[model samples]
Target: MKMMERLETFLVLAECGSFTEAAKKLFCSQPTISHHIQKLEEQFGAPLFIRTGRTAQLTRQGEIFLDYAKQIEQTMLQAGSAIESSMKTESSIVSVYVSQYFANYYFDEILPTLHASDPPYRLEINAYCYEALKQALVDRKTDWAIMPYYPDDDFIRSDFAVHALFEDEFMLVLPPEHVLMNRKTIYARDLQGATVLLPRSPFLIRSLQKEMDRHGLRVQYLQMSNFEVIKQAVKSGLGAAFLPYRAIRKELEAEELTAKRLPFFGYLRQNGVLVRKGARFTAEEQAFFERLRPHFDEGAPAGRSAFS
Candidate 1:
């Protein structure tokens, strides 16, 4: 018999305190129990039990082995339980995390199609700010992520794979009737001293600042953290802001905001699907990601074409 099986027999016999009783409990004959115990004692090079008239008593060595045997059994049980839990979680649900921007602009656009396809697994999708989403991806707390910003860290690059889905431009957004609407082309210097709405997150604000510095543009800032709020502010003629054109496509179509092309801001943000390197995804999970990629149009708006 295997060492583990022998150890299990030893544990049960030790608990029963009688060879005959142990055999009865294990649904085996008394001689079979004797054989297993004898094999165990021989392997350990000591007597694990002492026979007294009708009862079996543990020896000193047996007590020490008993502790180790119990520990091994408990470890095996816990390992089994953890693996089972992991399997259930993976098979039943697909966990995906998205940046706040992607969730806001693309989630509703994609949901109806996803539902119509009738996927096998349930989806638990969460939207987080850029910083929070980055942290979650680094910690492996999410199975998949869709975000615009990719961390420039070597560890992240080596440990994760990023599939570029689509590109969206960060254009100069202004109220439809703003003075700049008449300008055929907008340059960074054109907005000098203009009040520009800024995202509130420190990480995002810092990134925007670096881009502005690179282009040699200086503007007064009005901080509004939420994207929806920023769009509202622009519609209300609060200020001109730099925002992803796709994010404000509907508003632009309705003439609520006038979007101007800024050559310097082009190709600044590429939204992509991010996943851990060397992960074994379930069939359902893989199917979901495959279906999702086609919804984003490259170098254009979302929901247009497959990744090309």
Candidate 2:
């Protein structure tokens, strides 16, 4: 049997923990599955599994082998994808991880342009929270990530390149009946002694706290992770919270929520594109980025600004 076939059989056996189950999964007879594993063990000169009466467990050697098998499988898959992409005039698959806010607001506008190009592309958007977004990039599960402004991290700076796409300011969201709701512009000091609902992520919360500290203001609030939940809490008069202006635009326009611009918040969140550093872009991705450049430029006039 071929090495690839043996590797596939081994992976299935590891996952299913039985020859019968692996056979069923691979749609082959039990003997065929057993034969593949037997050959693999013979070639490696090590027992791969600890056979009990009816169950099997991976030996220490098996565990190490499994890791390499998985890596090989992934590399093979990536190689196959690369070849398939080359055969086509343009590849359709472009996977991306984008924040919920960006997916909801800007993806549609960008899609039309991508679709209009030759060798049409299909965009798969994975909407993830902060941590998941970073993981997707690290795992190479996504071709790109769209995220809010973040502090420069060594990993991201060294392994990924970021392009600024747009920017929006943070605003205080308050219930219409709240005391601060009537203010044309909200100051951080107004939050003192108030139950402010803030996002629970340490990175985001810390950034907000740092900004408040610089201005000698303190906001005391219960932290919640879900943005929608925070909005509901604010609307129900539970507390005030901060959100990007774009995120609350509809609510502000409909008067469902009142948003006061925070002048004291010196920095605006730059929504940007992130691509893996030193990774060669497929032709389609290169073309897609080229087309996207103009739209990113056009967004600057609205509020997009560079951070020093």
Candidate 3:
């Protein structure tokens, strides 16, 4: 048990990259975290981390040990699951991590129906940025992740099972009184001299730059970190933005905002659900996945080859 505690502390410290943050997460003191890490290094016969200022970076040996530590955690989880199944006790709770857009726009409405079914499966959903979403799966913290997929997204490797979902189209969103609101179609060239509000997503920014360059338009950009903030910026008449249709669906319907097709290709944002390739799903988790299937686009065939 002491060794297990040490390994757990090591994993958390690696994940956090800071002993102070790891201590806060584990509800322990910094000295205790240091003690556990020191013991791990002694058992492994090597210094695991190279400590700098306030950060702890894994050495080559530490990187190798991370995989083994994760395997131990996973094995324990499986053993617990097996014991719980034998006892036929508590319901299964599956954890899913998703992007903020999905949480705000889609899942709020979908969760109710999912929770109401017979033999209702317990679900634990956490939302994070795209990078954190991927890390959660790598660390085995979450069972699945849902996020926007891009053509250049190389992270969806062979080790992942991907279900390519719908393409959320990027549209030109405008305030009701904007000059472009009266235009029949919003073309890329038409964006000349227009200030465009943009989210800080690297993929979206790169795509936007490519399209702008293709049209030879030197448009002004106001970069924001939050999607809600981008939407409000457009609504406040600060600038027009290119956002997914689902993101502004309600505003368009209510006439608080106006949306137009981008009048060119390569504006679609693909999305997908991903799980680790060899995961063993309990009956309840499988049922929850089935319930979610009908709600999303029924386009992608099951077990589609990695997101390409």
Query: TM-score for all predictions?
Result: 0.65, 0.63, 0.66
Clashing pairs in 1: none
Q: Report how far off residue 76 is in candidate 2 (Å).
A: 24
Candidates in order: C-alpha RMSD to true structure: 9.1, 16.1, 19.6
Per-residue lDDT over 19-43 for candidate 1, one digit per residue giving the tens place of the 0 to 100 score: 8898889898888888999999888
On lDDT, the stronger of 1 and 2 is: 1
Q: Residues 1-308, candidate 3, lDDT per residue (tens digit)? A: 99989989999999999999999999999999999999988887999999997789999999999999999999999999999896664556766678888888898778888878776657777998777777787788865677776666566565676676667878788898888778886676678888988888887788877877787878898998877899888888898888888889888889889888765745777677776777766666656666676677754556433322
How many collisions per candidate? 0, 0, 0
- Estimate the overall C-alpha local distance difference test score of candidate 3: 0.80
lDDT of 2: 0.76
Model 2: runs farther than 4 Å from truth? 1-90, 116-119, 297-308
TM-score of 2: 0.63
